[model samples]
Target: MRVFDAKLKLQSQLRLMRSENNTIGMVPTMGALHEGHLALVRQALSENDVVVVSIFINPTQFNNPEDLNKYPRSMEQDSKLLSELSEELLIFAPGIREMYPESVESVSYNFDGIEEVMEGKHRPGHFDGVATIVEALLRAVSPDRAYFGEKDYQQLQIVRKLVSQKQLPIEIMGCPIVREPSGLAMSSRNERLPKRLRKEASFIYKTLQAAKVKFGTESAIEVSDWVDNEFNIHPDLELEYFEIADAETLRPIRRKQKENKYRAFIAVYAEGIRLIDNIALN
Candidate 1:
């Protein structure tokens, strides 16, 4: 596998591939490779002639400076992990200056109301950072398709909206959420969890599952309350926010709509590390 830290050189190579009619797939990441990340790259490799995995920990995406500092960075380890998957893979590991030559601030975007709820509500400018880095990466790579994990269902929806509004000719593919055997959703942040808390973190998914079961006989608000209560009783996990919202609009609903699909989104703090997960209801 070859790594390109320079955007110009990477784009120049991609242009050659374009001339040869090679379909390019992109898997954008923030380093600290995990199975979940590898899963995206695997899907990209299967479908596209060439896959470009960009591993730049975007500073613009972190609203909290501490979270940004604590975020994992293991390029050598990440590169080795990718190499085991495919030698044909291209790695775009650019420096902060390379990604943002002028300023490092996130550019604001109006992703309808999709950017104003759940994560958006909690993290303030988090989605703006997400939109900014994703737009920059999309522009830099210009791949035929880009892959994202469904674990971040909200971000997935917002990215689709961003592409539609921008009229970008690229397919945004949402892969399934990879989980541990205990059902904890795989996240780069999972690394920060204490050993015991890591096991306790499975409760987060269990609560989501129970909430799903309750949704059939209970109201959205009722199910949400149950989820809240479950976390309240848990010793290690603290619930940040749990909402059953329209899967498309991501607006929390009071009652389930017969015409609309619903999903339960939850965020919990295991110690100081934040972990998030979501499940479809009906």
Candidate 2:
């Protein structure tokens, strides 16, 4: 595996690959790799001649300072795990200094309302930072295909928009969300959960499952209320938001929704760490 920290050198090498008609796949990650990340890497390996994984914990994406301070980081362990997966894998491990040599300001392309709701509303400039770093990474890697897990469904959609609008010559593909057999979605943040709470964490998925079952019969408001009540039953779980929104736009449904289709997005604080999951209801 070849690793490069400098953006120029990585871009130069990537250009050579494109020149030679080698298919390139990019998997952008925040490090502290988990099954969710490995799933993306494996997908990239299957479809492209070369797989490139980026490990940069972007600081600008964090709206909460304390959460930023607490996010996991294990470079050697992450690299070791990736090494065994694909011998031809390329790693872009740029330091904050290397990534952002200037001020924290980012010249970003926004999706207007799309960038201002759900995860965006909760995290403030979180997605803006995400968009910025992603644009940088996409430009640097310039992969023929980029893979993202549906675990971050909204973010993946936004990236698809970015790629489409920017005409960046990249295909943004959303892989299935990897989950533990118990139903809890796999996440790097899962490591922060206390063991006991980790087990209780599966309840989040169960609640969503119940919500999904209501589908055509229940009103959006009704299903949302049930999810809220389910979280109420588990007082240990701090409910952030349980909402039904437009799948493409991520906007809440104030009244009845047409096409009777929407996405169920939920975020809760379990064991002091926030876990998010979503399902599509049609």
Q: Which candidate should be chosen as best, given lDDT against the real structure? A: 1
- TM-scores for all candidates: the values are 0.99, 0.96
Q: How would you encode candidate 2's per-residue C-alpha lDDT over 155-259 as one tens digit per residue?
A: 988898888888898989889989988899999888888888888899998888888888668788888888778888886799999888888778888666666
Predicted candidate 1 versus true structure: per-residue lDDT over 61-103, tens digit per residue: 7888999999888988998999999999999989989988999
- Model 1: residues with Cα > 4 Å off, grouped in runs: none
What are the runs in model 2 whose C-alpha is more than 4 Å off?
A: 254-260
Best by TM-score: 1
Q: 100 in model 2: Cα distance from truth in Å?
A: 0.8
The residue-level lDDT of candidate 2 at 244 comes to 86
**Candidate 1 residue 91 C-alpha distance from true site, Å:** 0.4
lDDT of 1: 0.93
